[model samples]
Target: MALSCGIDFGTSNSSVAIVKDGTVGLVPVEGDHVTTPSAIFFQRPNNTVYFGREAVQMFFDRAGGRFMRSLKRVLGTPLMTQGTLVNTRHMQFGKIIAAFLQNLKTQTDVFAQHDVLNVVMGRPVHFVDNDAEADRRAQEELKAIAQSVGFRNVEFQFEPIAAAFAHEVNIQGEKLAIVADLGGGTSDFTVIRLSNRYLRKADRAADILASTGVRIGGNDFDKDLSLSIIMPEIGYRSTYGEKHLEVPLHTFHQLAEWSKVNFTYTPKVIMQTRQILHQSHDRKRYKRLLQVLEQETGHTLLGAAEQAKISLTGQAEHRAAFGFIEDDFFVNIQRREFDDAIQYEVDKITASATQCLNQASVRREDIDLVILTGGTTEVPLVQEEFRRMFPKAAIADENKLSSVGLGLAYDSQNKFGDGQP
Candidate 1:
C-alpha cells in the first residue's frame, strides 16, 4: 500500500501528518515532537548534518559552521538561486531545501512502512505578497523540490484553508469561519463556509470564500524590536560628523534582520563599519558594533531579540542580556514597547483580515468562528485584534500549531483515499 501525507514546510518549523486508522494524526518529525524547528546545522569538522532541535543545538554549540533558518523566505527571491558556502562547500539554497525535505521523507519512512509518494503541501495564501507571478513561481519551485525528494503526486493547499479544515473536523454545526495563519514570514487569512454537511464533500473549492495574505509576521516583529531596543546600544542612531550627521543605518538594519544577517558578514560591510567607527562621534557604541561583527554573533543577537519578543507576549517586561557582545550588556523591554515596535505589522495584518472579509462580502459579525494557527498567533496583541474585530465570534485555537499539517492530512485522505504505491 502507498501512504499519502500532509507536509507543512513552515518558515520557522515543519511538520508531517497522515490519516491513520481513519483519524488524522501528527507524525513526529524530530525526537517525538510533531512540529520541528526548520533549521539546518552543518558540522564542519565531521561534515555532518543535523535537523530540527539537534540542528539548533549544534548551531549554538559548534565553533565554526553554517546554520541556516528561515529558508522558506528565500523562495521566489534571487537568493533562492544563489549558492552559499557551508563548510567550505558550495551548495545552492534549492538543494539545501531539497535535502531537508528528503530527510523528512526518510524519517517518515522509518515508522510508516508504506511507500509514501503522494503528498499535500501547505503553502501561504501569497508566497510573494501581491506579486502573482512571483507567488506562482514560488509554488513551482516548491513543487519541483518535492518531486526531487520522491513525492510523485504533489498537491497544494492554502495554509489558512488547511487550518480551517482541521477546525472543521470537530465542528458540528455550520459556521462562517475565518482562519488566521500567522507563520514566521507571512500572515494569511481565509474566510470559508464550513459545516458537518460540507465535511463529507470531496472538494471544498465552493466552500472557500476569500483568501488574503501579507509578508508580515513574527520575524518582522523581531526585527522591529531589535531595531528599537537593541540597535541603539550599538550605534544605530548615533552621529559621525561635525554636523552631527547620523550614522548609516542600512548595515544596522541588515544586522537586525534575520535573513539579512548572513549578508552583513561580508568584507565590504565590515570595512564600511570600520570606516564609520573611525569617524563616529559615538565611538563606544561603534566599537561595540565592530566587536559584534568580528565575533560573528549576528545569530546570537537575533536569537536574543526573538526571545525578548516571545517573552513580551505573556509578560509585562523582559530583559535581553547580550553577554556575547559585552559582559553585562543587556536591554529591558516592556510589552508596550514591543507593541509599539510591531504596530505597523499588526496593523497590516488587521487590514489583511478586513480585506479577506470584504472580498468574501461578509460582515465581521457574520463570521461565526475565528480559528488561529501558526506559532506567532500566541502574541497577545494579535489575539486582542481578533477579539476586537469579531467580538461575537468564538475564537478557536485548538490546533494552533498542527492545524495546517492536520488539515493537509485530511485533504490528502479526501483526495487520494488509499494512494497507489
Candidate 2:
C-alpha cells in the first residue's frame, strides 16, 4: 500500500487524511477530532511540550508556559527570517511548524501502522496576494518543513482546488462551480468545471478557470470583534495624563490578535505598558491591560472572543466574560454587532468571489454550483454573501472542516497510485 496522506496544516486547525481501498477518509489527530487546533505550548519547569488540544489545554490550565497559535501566519513574512524566543530557547517559525508537522506525522503513522513518506499538502490560492515571490517563499518554507518531517515526496495543491476534487465525486453532470474557502487566516476562491466525466480524466489543468484570494479570514474577524467589543473594556481608547492624550493602543491591538500577541511580550513593551498604567487616568482599564501582560493571558482572551463569535453563529447574542483578566469583566455581543464588526471582511470575500467570475469570463448566472469549505463559512454573514452572489446555483454542502484534507487525499491517490505525477 502507498503510505501517503493529505495534510491540511490550517491556520486554526490541522488534519490528515489517507486514501485506502479506493476510498478517502480522515485520520483522527486528537481523540476523535480529525481536525485539531493548530496550537502548541512549551511548558515551564522541566521544559515539557505539547501540541494541538493538549497544548491549548495546558495553557488554559495556567502551566506558565509559552503558547503560540497561528504559527502559519509567520510564513512568507520577515518574522520567518528572525526566530522568536520560546521558553528561553530561540526558534524560527519554520522550526515551530516542523514541530507541529512532525507531530502530525507521528500520529498518522501510528494510526496507519506504517511510515507515511509521501504527502499532498493544501495551501491557499495565494499566501500573500499579488506577491508571487512571497507566495513562492511561503510554499518553499512549507515544503522544507514537510521534508524535514520525513516526507520524501511532497506535492502542493491549492486548497480550494483540492476541495473541488472532493466535491466532484458527488456531481452527476457537467457544471461550473465556485469554491469559497474561508479559512482562519485567508479566504480563497476557485472557479472550475466539474462533472463525473471530468473526474475520470487524468488532466484537470484546464478545468480550473480562475483563482483569487485575500489575506482575510476568521482570525481577522476575531481581531476586529476583539477591537470593537472586547478591547475597549481593557483600555483600548482611554486617555492618559493631564494632557489627555489617548492611551497607547498598540499593546491593546496586539492583545486583541493572536499572531501579534507574542511580539508584545518584549521588555520594552512591558515597560511602556507599565509607564502608561502609572500615567493613566483610567487606572482600572490600564490595569486590566497590565494583567494581560503580566499573566500572559492574551490567548485566553482571544479564545474567549473566538468562542463568542462561534456562539453568535447559532444564538442572537453571546457574552464574553473575562473573569481571568478582571473580576466581573464581561461584554455582551449581539449577532448584529459581530456582523457589523466583520462587515469589512465579508465585503472583501464577496468581492473576491465576484472577481473570480469576472476573471473567468463566466457570468454569475452561468455558475451551476457554489461550494463552501473551511470553518468560517458557518457564519451567517459569510453564508449570506454566497447566497446573494450565487442566487441561482445549487450549493454542494460538504464537511467544511475536512473537505480540503479529504480532497488532498484524493489528489494524493491520483498522484502516487496511478503513477501519473
lDDT of 2 by residue, 1-421 (tens): 4677899999998889987666678999998889999999888855577999999999899887789998888889989989888888887889888999999999888887778888999999888877999999999999999999899999999999988988898888788999999999999999999986776566788999999899889999999999998888888899888899998788778877788888777889888889988889889887888888877788888999899999999999997899998788888999999999999889988899899899999999999999999999999999988888889999876789889998899888888773221
Estimate the TM-score for candidate 2. 0.96
State the lDDT of candidate 1 residue by residue for 1-421, as single tens digits: 4678999999988999976555668888887889888888877766588888888887677457778888898899888778787777878889989988988888776757766788999999888976889899899999999999998899999999889888886788788999999999999999999886776589788899999999888888889999998899888899997788898788789887777777777788889889888889989888888887887788888889999988887799998898888889889999998989988889999999999999999999999999999989999998999999999999899767888998998899888784444
Worst 10 residues of 1 by lDDT: 412-421
Give every collision pair in model 2: none
Candidate 2, 295: how far from true, in Å? 1.3
At residue 73, give the lDDT of candidate 1: 88
Please report the candidate that would top lDDT against the real structure. Answer: 2
Clashing pairs in 1: none
TM-score to true structure, per model = 0.97, 0.96
Q: Which stretches of candidate 1 lie over 4 Å from their true place?
A: 419-421
